[model samples]
Target: MQHLEDRFNKRFGYPWVFLNEEEFDESFKTAVKGQTSAPVSFGLIPRDHWFQPEWIDEERATQGRMEMKAANIIYADNVPYRNMCRFNSGFFFKHPLLQPYRYYWRVEPDIQYFCDVTDDPFDYLRDNKKTYGFTISFYEWEKTIPTLWATVKEFMNLHPEYIAAENAMNYLSDNGGETYNLCHFWSNFEIADMDFWRGEAYTKFFEFLDSKGGFYYERWGDAPVHSIAAALFIPKDELHFFRDIGYRHEPFQHCPRGEDWMRGRCSCNSYDTLDYAPQSCISRYEKMFH
Candidate 1:
């Protein structure tokens, strides 16, 4: 991450970083790390465990929570980490310090990039009311996500108080509790409005989900967790498409300039980019050879 930041700064000039202690590794701190680049500061959210360890979740949740609580100490002391994880990384606060910054671009280390970004994405968000933005999209992991749906349903059931809320409850539910079509997003790289996150709806939503303990048991990835929550909590119109920055999404490739992003790419041929439109889901899902 440090090497990437150094190179990123040299290229982009003090890019903003939402980072954590884990990124504080020797390689990371060496370059124009956090403070080196003015507003390019790091959020430094606390991370309990990397979620890479021994023992099944059922046996280790208690230990995990303890570690997470210890990490939260930094926030309690008024210190904050730019990087945040939903589970043990307890930095899901009310967006206190983020007000000054008009935009937030999520940063994760070690990902592939194929094309250069010609347009300025941050300016796009700042100029327009694009409260939510992402590059890739996919369905939920049914096994791991069943609990998430259940948790969301239970939250709505118990808080019938928020049934009338304008932001979240609506987007998360169209056919009652059957689906979450609006929950699709590529959170590995999210650049959004901080004001939208600091709202009461999102604030309480995170807290409600946080209390559920699934972040420990089900092993929720912050990317998907945040995606679902943001989908539920943020308005759809504020969402946007950056059809130019090239990004690698695990098994898929994203290219804004590729003829695909210009229209839609779902070709099995990895040689060509995949499609973003759902109409291509059929032929594209048939084979994985590409």
Candidate 2:
């Protein structure tokens, strides 16, 4: 919290909304509130939105977990993690406390912001008519989403009218929607318009995916879900890559090069920037506009 306050929130004074499955203790609230003068809100995830739907087959889900565990998949044995993924994928935007806000900047703990933000990203998104903006892109774990692409293809075939004519399909699919090439924008560092997710197109898309039971039967992540929606429902130009904001999350870091680094007081080495790493899809994302 202190790191974030010192980096950007202190200057912007934007309110912080924190959501958890359980009530936050007083100490947690005090620590967060003390970091910045910005209003801090703690929201509890509604029971219905954070639990497995009644229609899901518990036995099948158990078997799926066992299979994934045997295969050494990450978080395969964690039920709450799966629930968190499902909630973020389909229900987070619908929370009552978030309804009044038109734009949201998703931030996670332990992530670093190397740059001092000079302008409000929300203004950039609104003035430029952008629906989705992100700092990093990567290929999804194929093992984790074996059936997701097939499900998406079915949705596209059933609702062709919902797709944009100038979508970023090339960035997602190589065989013309026959299969998912696994590329997706990492959702952890997103600043997006909530109206896009609240719209009929995205709502119906989420409903369709939810009905298929992938959230429990398979591990469907919010990153891939949001990425597919942005790539298909929004125009190519409306999706932005926030290259100026130097950011890092765990294994990867995006350090701005040259002037951006010097002006931002960034301490990271430009050569270590993962923007051009083989595992990243940033180069492909750049080709879409460049």
lDDT (Cα atoms) of all candidates against the true structure: 0.51, 0.89
- lDDT digits (tens) for residues 173-217 of candidate 1: 456557554344667777777666666655676677766655554
On a 0 to 1 TM-score scale, where does candidate 1 land against the true structure?
0.65
lDDT tens readout by residue for model 2, 1-290: 67667877888999899999899999999988888899989999999999888889999999888988899999887889889888988889999889889999998998988887777889999999999999889999887788999999999999999999999998998877888889999988899999999999999999999999888888888999999999999999999988888889988888888888787787678778888999999988888786
Off by over 4 Å in 2: none
Give the CA lDDT, 0 to 100, for residue 261 in model 1. Answer: 43
Evaluate candidate 1 by giving its C-alpha RMSD to the native, one decimal.
Answer: 9.0
Candidate 2 local lDDT, residue 147: 92
